[model samples]
Target: MRGTVAHLVPVADPDEVATIIAASKRAVGAAVESLHFPLVPGVAAAIAETDNAWRALEAEHGLLDAAAVSRMLGSRGRPGALANDRRSAGKLIGVRRRHQYLYPGFQFDAARGRTRPAIPALIAAADDAGLPHDELALWLCEPSGQLGGDRPVDRLDDADAVVTALSAHVGVQW
Candidate 1:
């Protein structure tokens, strides 16, 4: 990490930076090993459970990386920046992980090889209602009472219904 490098080396000095990076790598490796030490069973189990839950959610929702989304938009099988661009524009809802964004697959219309038409409107409606993007992802994935307990993502194709539900959820007309 930057903190590790900053503590041990002058970042502008290439040689010292390289040496510090090597040392940092070893320290990180040791730290990783310690993570699974016998004394940390409870901590390890909690980490595993959280990781498993994230994986399960990703699997159930068809979480797609930017490259996959580019292809879905008919990018000729080449990864492009379209997905990230859209996310920046608020025309797409991409869940930001550590270093990347994962777009929920429900936004795409597979048969058309493009984003569902109502998705932009939905995104705009959320923006208008002052809903944060991160919370929107969670709201979409979870079953909602306003939606008759169906997850919003599952009913995205029904724009009217989803909009109505979103309006009720956010207390704003969409």
Candidate 2:
């Protein structure tokens, strides 16, 4: 449920940005519904439940190293601020590859920059949760081919498809 909230304006076309935004909203909404809960949960219980589930999966799979998660989150600088921001951390995968990355709400060192593929982080996280890794990886990376310096409307559609597929694969409500 925790996500970044900054508005992402694609460098392509305004119309494309609008389309991407709409598709993103629909995709996220669908994902939330598939999960049987809202993307941004209103109650603490929901958050705790999700967190506990993730933690339990992590303990079970050992796919993601705690050091990696800690390092990634810590490297971002203002972890609290980033969490409050509604943007998907996974989105950074594309932004990092396409533009001068700026997590507006977080206090990270813009200079250090990103070193690994953002999609990998999501895969690792999912893996640690005992989730299907191969399927999720395909879903997450499917959009990369459509994304570039151009308008991301097409990529956004691909992303939506990926998220929708992932939601279904994970038995989440979308």
Candidate 3:
């Protein structure tokens, strides 16, 4: 992606820039269109299976619904501040289930009295990879052989490792 963007950097001509921009837009459009193409019969089932596994994992780890999170954070009723943080700062990510959002409890950095600083970067990397919120949370909490069986959340102290792991998970160099 950087390589694609870098091709436009040296261009000083307005027309050339416009041409590059148009090409970029076309490329992005094709990518987006590809996502909507019909999946193989087993692919949708596989995704459903993966989601079920993640849900079981989430149950084991325990999750906090929006109201529960608001109560735990001592900011009951609407959780406007936390919601804002999720959108504006990427400090938190919520998975929607049954029309309500559920937050992962581990994301709250009790030791620091806030969400972990590295969370936003992780979220960004996952977003770039097109990972959904629930799957992202499950990925963070589950032990991975790639990290010597360490859950990604446990490596939050090392932001670089988390970023690398996220990039690797998404198969991007980042």
Candidate 2 residue lDDT tens string, 15-96: 7767776776786567667875445556544654444443433343323222333344554554434422322434332122
Q: Which ten residues in a row have the lowest lDDT in candidate 3?
A: 1-10
Q: Pick the candidate with the highest lDDT.
A: 1
Error of 2 at 64 (Å): 17
* Ranked by TM-score, top first: 1, 3, 2
lDDT of each: 0.75, 0.39, 0.69
Model 1 superposed RMSD (Cα): 13.2
Q: How many pairs of residues collide in each model?
A: 0, 13, 0
Q: Give the top-scoring candidate (TM-score).
A: 1
Estimate the TM-score of every prediction: 0.63, 0.22, 0.59
Q: In the order shown, what is each candidate's alpha-carbon RMSD?
A: 13.2, 19.7, 17.1
lDDT string, candidate 1, 1-174, tens digits: 364434434357777778876886687568777765444446644654455445556777677999889878877644758888888887778887667898877788878988877678778888989987766766777798988899888898888888788878899447
